[model samples]
Target: MSPLVALVHATPAAIGPARTAFAEAFPEAELWHLLDDRLAADADAAGGLTPPLRKRMLTLIGHAVDNGADAVQLTCSMYGPVAALAGQLWDVPVHGSDETMLRELGWSRPARVGVIGSLDSAVADSARRVAEVVPGAEIVPITAAGAAEAASSGDAERLSAALENAARGHEVGVFVLAQYSLTPQWMRLEAALSTPVLSPPQLAAGELRRNLLEAP
Candidate 1:
């Protein structure tokens, strides 16, 4: 039987891109989506991950594991740290959204890494992780102004433009789109900047497939 991979999403915008990524990267795996649309708004309102919010995220992850998930992936970068806690509580492998991408970046030993995101919180979290993984490398946090609004409004052009505009001057060894919502724009962003662009979904999918499906 194909392994069932549960995707825990904090926003609806991440769903399509994540599905596309999994389909391309781990086509044989079955997908289960667990969405809490208000998760992001609640985190933003509370000025980041609060205690109650953390509990709620854990509950969702637990539910996914209980429902026969072979592994779980959190699609929100803001609540990424919660994955670690969830891993302790569940027997299934639980993964934070950007872990694989950040790990790869660390292996590359880039001199400077640019983290681009629609939300400042997500960018900051990703930048912090980058710092942890690549201590000697410079971390640049770029908040794509208006990109969140554009994404919410379903304005792809505006989203791409905002990201491009924000990323215009920064010349980094590699660029990381910190939010899963920004994954769909990675190709365009990479082409415009002429640099390697990394996003979470595809990398996470591949990692999960390797660990769960290909492991001997």
Candidate 2:
């Protein structure tokens, strides 16, 4: 039987890449999307994660739990700590979208980590996650200027072009796409650079598959 994995997303942009990852990497696992754009709006309004924000995240996890999700993953990279706490609370495999990527990069011990994100908050959040895994790692945060707007406007070409531009001229072991919306440009970004690209959606999907389907 296929395990059901619930995906909690703070923005609409994460949905497509997440769904695509599930289809491409682990189609046997049923995918469920729980989107709350207000989560992002409120988080932004508050300037950071607050106690109330934590509670709200827990509530979303609870919803996934009630729906019989065998595992839950947040498509939003900014909520890494919240997802960690949720994993403790739920006794299930709870994961932040970029956690797997962070772990991989940490093991690689890259001296200069490159991060590309659609929003400033995402860039900061991803950099912090990278620091957590690889202490004192030099992080270069680059904003995919106008990429968020292009994504929201449903202009894939424009978003890809913007991310491609933002990712160029970076010398690092790997470039991390801080937002799932940027995953579609992973191959192009890899081609443009001399390093590999780490995609949150792909990594998260593989993590879920490893924990659920491949766990022995």
Please provide, for model 2 over 125-194, each residue's C-alpha lDDT reduced to its tens digit, 9 standing for 90 to 100: 7887787787777889999899988877778789878988887777777789888877877887687675
Give the TM-scores of the predictions, in the order they appear.
0.96, 0.95
lDDT of 1 by residue, 1-216 (tens): 999999999999899889999998999999999999999888877778999999989999999999899999999988888998887888899999988997898788899999998887778878988999898999999999999988877788999999999998998999999888888888999999999999889999999999997899
Q: Please report the TM-score between candidate 2 and the true structure.
A: 0.95
- What value does the lDDT take at residue 133 in candidate 2? 83
Off by over 4 Å in 1: none
Model 1 Cα RMSD, 1 decimal: 1.1
lDDT of 2: 0.84
| Local lDDT at 180 for model 2 | 84
Winning candidate number (lDDT)? 1
